[model samples]
Target chain A: MTPRPQQEPTCHGEDYAPFERALLNDYQHELPLVPRPFAAIGEQLGVSEQAVLEALQRFREQGVLSRVGATLKPGAVGAATLAAMGIPERDLEQVAAIVSARPEVNHNYEREHELNLWFVAMAADDAALRAALTAIENETGYPLLDLRLVCDYHLDLGFDIQWTSANETDA
Target chain B: MDVSERDRRLIGALQAGLPLVRRPYAVIGEAVDMSESEVLRRIAALRDAGVIRRFGVIVRHHELGYRANAMMVWAVPEHQVDSLGERVAESPQVTLCYRRRPAPPQWPYNLYCMVHGRDRETVLAVRDELVARHGLEGMEHRVLFSGRRFKQRGARYLAPKQEAIGREANHGRA
Candidate 1:
């Protein structure tokens, strides 16, 4: 993999209001499954239903929230694999575009490693997954490292962000 | 479990996102031409059937002050991976953990775990503790911090016809 500059954390500073932060940190993992979920959130948070809806809308618009929906378990509905490819620097963008062009490819990232171009592909079944991987390998001309997940543990991406340095540890 | 055409449409609409409104189901039903009750019923059925995992807020970790994130891979003995993976995942600091196929000759790490924290140092500390606790001191491993995220989105599991249309669009662009 072509050596790229190490990435610094881009997300910093607490610019959001207290309610927004509370909504983000607390209500992220579980949104009540109700006819008026936002209303429930509002009732608990001491905010109006309209205020909760507006805050969520703003959060989604600002990229603070990806969505208000279900995170389908990998391999639950179909076959999926975490794949990586080692592409030459010159062909990185070309290869990445080719890989990302597939609709099944949900996540594509550039990591710091020899097998740089990493992505996750999901399809209707095993046959479709194999076909997609084979097509990507054939197009990119790079041997794909297909890593099927054996098991997922603690895969929750959402966590309570401690604004204070409560659990801060030295490097 | 087969999903009806209307249910497929609901899934497609939901994959995009549920609206932040008082009557979200009603709003979504209006868009998908389904009744509010029908949409609610279908969603419940989908959740029960395991098609939809859990309806919740998809938080952006980075945006929410999780600055440092590393995908750490370790080459553990094949037999020990399952047990070690469970132990490592029990830590709150380790957000994701799994056993993946190792790329031989170059990459020989089958066990992978993601550690996310407010800073690089915090993440590193967590990693060190995990390594020491798991007795993975002598193991060959590497921490690959995410440099740039090109794309991140929900997995699209629409109807086969919608999948075909998506492929066609991508092919046209290519």
Candidate 2:
């Protein structure tokens, strides 16, 4: 691997209000199951309901928060697999688009490896999921390395962020 | 628990997002023609039944300064997967750790864990620490760093049928 230049950090400390930090770190999981969920969050943070809503909305606009909803358990309602394909560098973009065009593909990422194009194919059931993967293989002309999850130890992707002193500003 | 038509519709509605409002349940209820209390009841019931895993803010790690992320796969003996997976999951740096069925002939890794950090160097240092601490120096492993994210979104389980219909309609147009 070649040495890469360090890139400047995108998120700054002043970007996070005290409440916003709490929302990102504390509320990553286990949102209150209430009629007015935002209101509950506000009460806990000592902020107004409107303020909570606005902050969340702003976060979404800024790409901080992807959504405010449930993180479904994998393979709970359907079937999925981590699949990879090795496409020549020249055909990478074309093959990636073909794979990404499928609605069953919720995640398609190019990674650094011989088998570079990695994606997760999700479907309503096992049969549908298999069909989707098969279709991708037929279309791409590249054999796929299909990896099915056998067991999960910890699948939570959410994590806390530590704001750096350089980025810190009075909230 | 069996998810009925009503529950499917509710899940579809909430899949994209919950309305950012004071009375989000009420807004969601209005969409499905259910009363606010009923929406609350069903959601709570679904949660208890494990149909809904968790309801919360979905933070984008990259936006939060976690620029370096790698999916580390290891070819561990089948017998050692469970114990090793547990240990890997216990690490704070590892957000996701699981045992997967490796594809033979081409792929031969069964254990997977996702490590995230502020930079590539940080992630590599943590990966080294994990390997040393877990005593997995002899295991065959590969680290794949994500390059371009082509697509990413919440799972669309209930909307598949609708999406299929939509696809057909678009096909006809083409």
Give the best candidate by TM-score.
2
How much is the lDDT of residue B156 in candidate 2? 70
Residues B90-155 of candidate 2 have per-residue lDDT tens digits of 999898898999887578899999887789999899889989999889999899999888887776
When summed lDDT is taken over every stretch of 10 residues in candidate 2 chain A, the lowest stretch is A1-10
Q: lDDT (CA) for every model shown? A: 0.75, 0.79
In candidate 1, how many clashes are counted?
0
Report how far residue B51 has shifted in candidate 1, in Å. 5.1
RMSD in order of candidates: 6.6, 6.4
- TM-score of chain A, model number 2: 0.87
Model 1 is docked with a DockQ of 0.49
Which has the greatest DockQ?
2
Grade the docking of candidate 1: acceptable
Model 1, CA-based lDDT:
0.75
- Identify the runs in model 1 with alpha carbons over 4 angstroms from their true place: A1-14, A155-157, A164-171, B1-10, B30-34, B41-51, B163-174
Q: List the residue pairs that clash in candidate 2.
A: none
